[model samples]
Target: MGVLFYGSAEHAIEIDDVALAHLKVVIATKLRRNESFTLSWMHDSGQPLGRSTIWLHPSIELRFAFEEPTPPPLDPAKIQAYANSANTSGGILVPEEHILGSSRGVVLTA
Candidate 1:
């Protein structure tokens, strides 16, 4: 598991490392261009009983922490899919299946 610490440490959102890695790319790209967007996702724990949306901006602080010391190899196809979502009006909707799916030949570091 990985945690996305947004705004502050107290506002950490749990996500898998693969998705976090892909999200990092899309987010960095958008933020680099000073583009702000809304990112929504269902709560993994279902504590919120629905979904949560956050306004991502260049000025906001974000952090991605993986359980493993090393990062996993990224999938270009998955990255492109996520990037497209991030570029859309709906913004990014973390693809759970793609994130937790089989690695195929991709090696994940512990």
Candidate 2:
């Protein structure tokens, strides 16, 4: 899995491919419209929340890692089953344990 770093320190906010793609689109759209602000997301662990300030630019790389093998496809039925299980918590879109494996990419505009 890839690690997110802030300068020299590692961050707790690990973004997977699916989330990363969506983020890129959202940011790009906003940037194209000349919008600049902070975007925040709460972590699944619930202990640490994270945010980043986004700006319009052609140079930002939108960095992420795809070094790990892809995870098994998520079955909606299985997702539902585990969602209701006593061991699980509700409200997260994609479960944290598998975030790095199931990410997709988005095309960017110059």
State each model's CA lDDT, in order: 0.70, 0.37
- The residue-by-residue lDDT of candidate 1 on 9-105, one tens digit each, is 4556666677778788888889999999987765443353456778998888888788878878988887898788888999987644433222222
Best candidate, TM-score-wise?
Answer: 1
Clashing pairs in 1: none
At residue 20, what lDDT does model 1 achieve?
Answer: 78
Best candidate, lDDT? 1
Residue 23 in model 2: lDDT: 45
Off by over 4 Å in 2: 1-12, 46-64, 67-110
TM-scores for all candidates: the values are 0.79, 0.36
The list of candidate 1 runs beyond 4 A from truth reads 45-48, 96-110
lDDT (C-alpha) at residue 75 in model 1 = 87
- Model 2 Cα lDDT, one tens digit per residue, 2-92: 3222233234345544444444455455546654434333333333344232232334434444325664344455434333331223222
